[model samples]
Target: MNFREFAAKNVHRNVKAYFAYFLSSSISAALLFSFTMIILHPNLGAIDLPEYLIKALNITTVIAYLFLFFFVFYSVSVFLKSRYKEFGILYIIGASKKQIQRMISIENMIISSVSALLGIIAGLVFSKILLAVSGKLLGFNALEFYLPVKAMLITFIAFVIIGIVISIFCSFIIKEDMVLKLLKGTKKPKTEPKTSTILAITCVVLLTTGYYLSVTSSTKTLAGRIIPVTLMVIVATYLLFSQLTIFIIKLLKRNRTLYMKKTSVLWISNLLYRIKDNTRMFFLITITSTVALASIGSVYAYWRDKEAQIDRSFPQAFFFSDIYDNSSMVDEKVNFIEGSLKNEGIKYTKVNDEMKFIIPKGEKDQVVIIKEDTYKKLSSILYLNAANLSENETILAMPLTKHGRKNVVLENIELEVASKLDKGIIPAFYEEVYVVKDEAYEKIKGVKVYFNTINVKDYKNTLNISNNYYNNFPQDNVNKYYNNLLKSGILRATKVAYGVILFSAIFIGLIFFVTTGSFLYNKCYMDIIEDKKKYNQLNKIGLTFKEIKKILNIEIGVLFLFPYIIAVIHYIFAISALKYAFELNIAVPSLQVIFIVLIAQIIYFIIIRKNYLLEIKKSLL
Candidate 1:
């Protein structure tokens, strides 16, 4: 048979072995294609997407493509390694190296062609749905789905290039290795693996340091610490898997009683090889899983907290600000605000506070004094109980205040402190505010500003009505209160933006999880040949099917769960650090993600276990 026929027959015969690689490649291609369509959509640029957001999407698409390349390369290399003996046999039968290379290339091209087609077809089918979901997240009224010609061309070209590269790379694998080595395959063993004392020590030290930094580092220092700590953790995880874990397993084997347990001898005898062989893979899976968890968790957490931020920053629907020194325009500005809200048919309540900006004669820090009655109005509006104030007592309403200290001397007035307000009810003014009796406030000769806070029943509709005011108002530093009120609209827009980002993160994270799971699945299945040979020997020595199953369970269970357990541990600490830094509770969102991932992993384990046991049964038969 010619090379093409040989290649076709080989793929048809071993399709099971190629299935994981094929599916993952198709999925990756589909995702890339879908994203490319969005990027090339004629109307995408016309939408209200921020330039930075557009740029981020573009960058992530490129990153996805790059990730696909490496992922495909790795899968191909592993699959090729499994076929080493087959290729060696062909070489020994007088098939020229050039013909073998051609056969391998043809096989890869066929697989890539099928994968790319499946991926593009999937993308075509889902592109509209994906775009619609994205549009809804972005709060766009409508986004017509259209498959752009350029997108299809780009995707085809990209995957074609990937196919060529894989083919070329696979050719080198055949050329470099000696025929004898290829024939021996994974059975070739020389020196036994020994634990490295230095590496074990380094692993412990590095991991402890990394975990300590991750746990203790707060948000303020997170940026500076995350990079270095991550590098340390990555290195440490590799070393631990490669040396420390193997060392511990060896120690366990040395425990005579435990080592003599049923099936322990069977599984433990070759555990060292499995651990050593898969150390790098385990590290990769753990790190990738952690990244997926952290990214999706962080984005969801931030998205969940967006509303709280908006509420804190824009407490009132609209607030008026004017220099109290020019008390003349205060009423005029208040009238304008009230009339504007009325024009929008917005039902509203108003809280008015008069304040004087002062530098306590000897102190340089500016402070604002308001009447007790005004403080009560502000408090009532904020749903906070009014503070009881006496003529001789003043309450300090500071945004950022010391916890226990309570005295302030303003203009030689020894004002007895009644209480303190952490954040004033009306957040329009951000100065150190003092609430005192009307008589006390009138006595101070200082510039006065009027704060007119408007609370509407439906602020969203009011925002639309007040759009004219926002556009008309020229933003000077003094008129920030008006500007802040306009911020409510921006907040609404930002919520949609964040929603889109959260959706994107979830999708990207899912891809990572699927790819990682596929890698582990493929590796486990590929080892079945060796497993069957070893287990057959045990079966002849009176090992029952149940014992074989138990052995396989322990082996496969460890293979499936080891990376996940480590990943979850890393994820928890990383999230805890984020929580400490941002002072935001991500517990609910984090738990939700954890639950979903856990469920997915359980399902994957069940499927893989079933398939593995079936393969073992077939091998025995």
Candidate 2:
């Protein structure tokens, strides 16, 4: 047959196979298309974005495409594996390897093309919604909603090139012999279940060590060390996720009473057994869940802490700042600010914040790791960001108390240990921070700023006043900086919040869908097979499908609850540690996440149980 007829016949013969191919292709295409909109926007000139932002966009775009590419590759592998017998059949019918290769290539092209179109449309719509939603959340009026043609073009090209290369490689490697070998499915292969006591003990030890390093080890300014430690925890968490539950289940089964107790026991045992065979998928789901939760938590925590930053920086409704005292806009803005505050019946005093810069004798880039709560206190005084660290030198920046003096251990101009009175000043409450004078400030020449700090009648009204003051005067330097940040922040915060919610629904829902869905489906499939023979044998002894399904439902419920129970307990202790590290005094997400999980579980239960009931009712009738 010609390629066209070959393609047509293949599609007609295997719609299910083609559908799977298209579904995966569509997913990849959509990711690429959406990223295109983000990176290749036409209206970039409106905001004077830094080059690094563009670079970051490019990097994330590339990474997203890579993730999608890997995902597609995985789907293709599964599809080929499932259709091995079909490949063998083609060979059996005397199709040459070259002919088979061509057919596969054509099929790949058709699948990719259709999926690309679907993905592009979906990407445009998704990007537009994302832009709009981000706009609404961040309170920005300028809507950056559009389909990026450049991104579309880029994604299209990448998709085609990558698809062709991967397709060719897979085809070249899809030896006809393997398909023939599996034409008659082999019996379950003998393999060891990963349930040894030694493995369990090793998992515990590795995870505990990782957790210890993350929680207690200081990593303030030392980003280098933090990376390895974080990686360790990530690695340990995944390893334990793969091996823990199976071992626990196996250990429980050693007890005759516990093993034979109720439907719950049997159910848990069966689930642990089944999942043992699919540890890789289970590990993936756990990893996704962990990352999703961490990303969402990080964003919200930053937002929550932003209030303190606004409080510190913008104490009054009207304020202004200048570097090197060079800006003419400050006086104008300050005058304008005073006028507006008076109009609103608010009283405030402008405080002159002349800071002394101090440099201690030795090293630059002083690095130290501390719990985040302590970091916050030190950051407020020093003006540094808190991150994971892997160093010992504690760098603290604090405003010099005196007008001019040199009290530092080291004296050098370029390396003179001078002070920078700009951002990242170290606080006095923390011992790591030191105060110096103007001469020390002169050492650090890159940053020079005069800060006009003000205090207002109400804390609640502070943000509003800051907003209005910036809105009225766009030309002021302080306002300009704030506006730039506000614009970008709104875009980011909205994306982060929406991403959290979306992944929350999609990721959590997916696991529940798969884990519960397959369990229920298996129940029905097993019933059909067993009733034909095993059920007949049991029925003669008075066992019924009604009894079997009841046992199955109870089994499903207990097995399903196992993960959540463990998750909740882990979550509680985890949050407690978080609170200590971050100094959080308010409501925690442990309850919230748990509540969401419960709701998902209930919905899952209803859907799965309903199907199980239907199957039983149908059989009984």
What TM-score would you give candidate 1 relative to the actual structure? Answer: 0.84
Name the regions of candidate 1 deviating beyond 4 angstroms.
93-98, 127-129, 141-144, 190-192, 196-219, 319-337, 351-377, 388-452, 469-483
The list of candidate 2 runs beyond 4 A from truth reads 1-28, 123-128, 137-139, 142-148, 192-194, 212-225, 261-273, 312-347, 353-452, 456-579, 584-621
| lDDT by residue for model 1 (470-520), tens | 565555665422323544675677777786677667667867877887788
Give the candidate number with the greatest TM-score. Answer: 1
RMSD score of candidate 2 (Å): 9.7
Query: All models: lDDT?
Result: 0.76, 0.50
Q: What lDDT does candidate 2 reach at residue 229?
A: 52
Clashes of each: 3, 23
For candidate 1, the per-residue lDDT at 353 reads: 65
